[model samples]
Target: MAHPERDTDSAAGTGGDPGSWPARQAPGARDLAGLDARICRCRACPRLVEWREEAARTKRRAFADWDYWARPVPGFGPPDAAMAIVGLAPAAHGANRTGRMFTGDRSGDFLYAALYAVGLASQPTATHRGDGLELRGVRITAPVHCAPPANRPTPGERDTCRPWLARELTLLRPTLRSVVVLGAFGWQAVLPALAAAGWRVPRPRPVFAHGARTTLRAADGGAPLGLFGCYHVSQQNTFTGRLTPDMLAEVLRGAAEAAGLPVAHAD
Candidate 1:
């Protein structure tokens, strides 16, 4: 019933009539700005921000002191998405500089490729948020919104950022069905969120393994939201062959199937 990719609002009233009324354009800047405003000046962890700005300044020599968002990176996707992809955090030169998750850095290259392969991403390159790339049913976000030094976020920082994720997920409401966590940290963050939603932790304690899957009922007792885990796809994993393209694709295939959607392969 959810034609996520189509502008369904356009055809809803006319019953295949082309001239009844134009479909409502998807939510735009005002919608995203409201979400961005919440974290614009987040000073939740002073130490983290200090380190982040220092990293930004250090890299400014090459970046030419580029105006960086420096603020917390907000999630990008349809407001009524069913699946959310959680990453570790923004990269220093990537989202940290570009102000968009997974953009302007090498780290995003493979990730975007994978998204494109799966029919989620429309553009092959995620140069910036303005590149006009749009996700269908999938939303991409992070646990720690800001990029941390060496890509390691302190426990305190992750804890502080949890509320934002919780609030956004709560807003998505009935449409959210599953969350795909990129690494151990993201998996850990989701646990407290699930608890906050009143779902008890799994009896055996869900392990954060590649290809892992679990389901927790929403607070409303409707359908349970599925959770899937995948390798972080960091430099180490890819260089050491711990995670191969085929392996990542297979895990995503499993996740997509669990979401009851068709899997698309790259030609």
Candidate 2:
């Protein structure tokens, strides 16, 4: 498979002033591919840049032979997706290593498994970007693109990264009909992006809860967007009974149906 990261480095340098790239580049992106290319090169947050690069250099023992991506991971899936899955951020050794959201991690294992079971993903596992995993009508993304220290990004960092999410939503506005926000962080972060992208978020902002559901009308009077909240597929939730296979499938199936996509019976 072609290693696109090698080419991305040179392009990133020419963009100028890493801290200002998102605000400057995001709105002007002509399409999803252009936006993703811009997202992959961001180095806006000094702390996150240092942390992601350090993790790549230190090299986790299990992946010692890997050429770590060590860059901001962009959203994965087709451009004209009807459903969107929003997560908090990439894992240090997961997406940070493979350069694909949810790849090389247990969280991805759980997520892809559920997606496959629901007939969205082409396969049940995502080991790398070139592994041939594909989503039929759904797109997966996150609030923060870089892996933060201890898997937590500061509020300032989240705000700084808001333009990317907002731009991504704007690009997907034509077909994006339903969203499954994983965890409270993603829920909190995505609401404003949705509003900024043309959806009219309800007053008294919606609270996050497992199985929580709401609808946001479009400012352009387009199709309404359905928002569903689900627990993060982190080990903490999956290892315990907090989030089960059936629970995840239920939410995904509902979202898929809401997006007017075909749903397969859960396995």
Candidate 3:
């Protein structure tokens, strides 16, 4: 269901700056491996820091026996990913508990299923960080690292955490050809981050809508990157049919194809 702009010359290996993503000049290049480590120790926002820690301490009855990550959830997948998925933030009982995006949550269950069906994911269930789920060519990240209260991040919280997302994109710009935004919030957050990281943004910007697609470049000389929009795979949406399996699959499949990933391959 992606719009026509999903595939472009930039995504076809002509994308990326001549040395657009040099190893040394990227946003915190020496820190990509250690990025997650730093994120986990962040206490930048007083409100989020307190909320995430308190939730970890007062464990939900269903997860009383579990030890929560209680820190920022870093992006997961290969460093040279061709495709990326961005979300709003971590779920209090989901990534906060399992230390992996969408892991140990119903929302994850729904998404992983679709990713698996399209051959992007190694498994359909992400039970834990060690559950062995693998993404073939896609990476998952979030605009906000920590879990926010009521699943809502204040404007300040989002801006405060954007550096992480921007840095990740800068590092991945060399190979990332497409991005799938999980919600409108993510769509809004990623645009500026990409532009700041050197991706060109059209004047007036593109509107967020299900199946909407846009193409931009890292810079005038950099490769073009495709952006696709999809409804968030939240329980309210899934349970109410706002986002159905078919709908999710349609978007992910289109993204994978644009990123030059095969629909099915035995691994």
Candidate 4:
């Protein structure tokens, strides 16, 4: 749906350095925890909330009455990670139900496999947040914290939810060495944040091609954070060969090296 080349000026509201955007950073780290609490019980958009609840209540047409998770999915990974993987949002019955980012979906299947293959994740199973799976130095989060109708959240909703994402990055600052953006939307959501923080955006922007890497200077400290862009391994991509396990693994390998972690070659 989102391609990197699509001019972002319309979506971002400004084509220049994002530092000019009017939004302010979250009040403090305490704001982060408070935002988390709100996310857990958010009913900001009544229509979407009702739709999500309805989806969970209804059985899959073919499956009749199968269980579904239809709630706010939270970010997951090692608390002290140097890298954070940013995704778009939760799949209807996937992370929304499981309460963890990128779980219980085809996208997640490919991603977790790559994460495990590269040793960033200790376990392949991401069925639940507490599945004993751990990311060595990586955390996974989404731009839209709440699941949206038909897997798409509106621009207003995304903007409303932007503060949560900002808070996450802010609280995880100093420790974050790099970020792996899983799709164009992920890149878009983060670029402005980086700009607002006074970071240098990569020339040509961060392209969405798999395994592409861009080095950026942090706004706060001028530290370099290697930004890696990748095509999302969504069902559309993986099943159609638009994304492959090996390809994704290569990106992970590069990201690991960028994060100063030991890299392992794919078998």
Q: Pick the candidate with the highest lDDT.
A: 2
lDDT of each: 0.71, 0.91, 0.82, 0.70
Model 2 per-residue lDDT tens digits across residues 1-267? 222323323455356666666777788777888888888878889999999999999988999999999999999999999999999999999999999999999999999999999999999999997889999999999999999999999998898899999999999999999999999999999999999999999889999999999999999899999999999999999999899989999999999999999989943
Model 4, 1-267: lDDT tens per residue?
122223323333244433222132233335334445435544455555677677677746743454565666656766567888998888777776666788876788789888988888887767766688888889898877667787777877677667667767776776777888888877888886666545688677766667778788876665688889889878878899988888888887887888888766865
Candidate 1 scores a C-alpha RMSD against the true structure in Å of: 11.3
In model 2, where do residues sit more than 4 Å from their true spots? 1-17
Model 1 pairs in collision = 10-23
Better of 1 and 2 by TM-score: 2
TM-score leader: 2
TM-scores of all candidate predictions against the true structure: 0.82, 0.94, 0.88, 0.82
lDDT of 3 by residue, 1-103 (tens): 1122232223311344322221212244344565565455556677887899999999899999999988888888888899999988999899999999889
The clash tally of candidate 4 reads 3
The clash numbers for all candidates, in the given order, read: 1, 0, 3, 3
Residue 224 in candidate 4 has what lDDT? 81
Better of 1 and 2 by lDDT: 2
Better of 3 and 4 by TM-score: 3
Q: State the TM-score for model 1.
A: 0.82
The residue-by-residue lDDT of candidate 1 on 33-127, one tens digit each, is: 45455454455566667766876777766687577766667787888777788889888778888887888876687777777788767876788
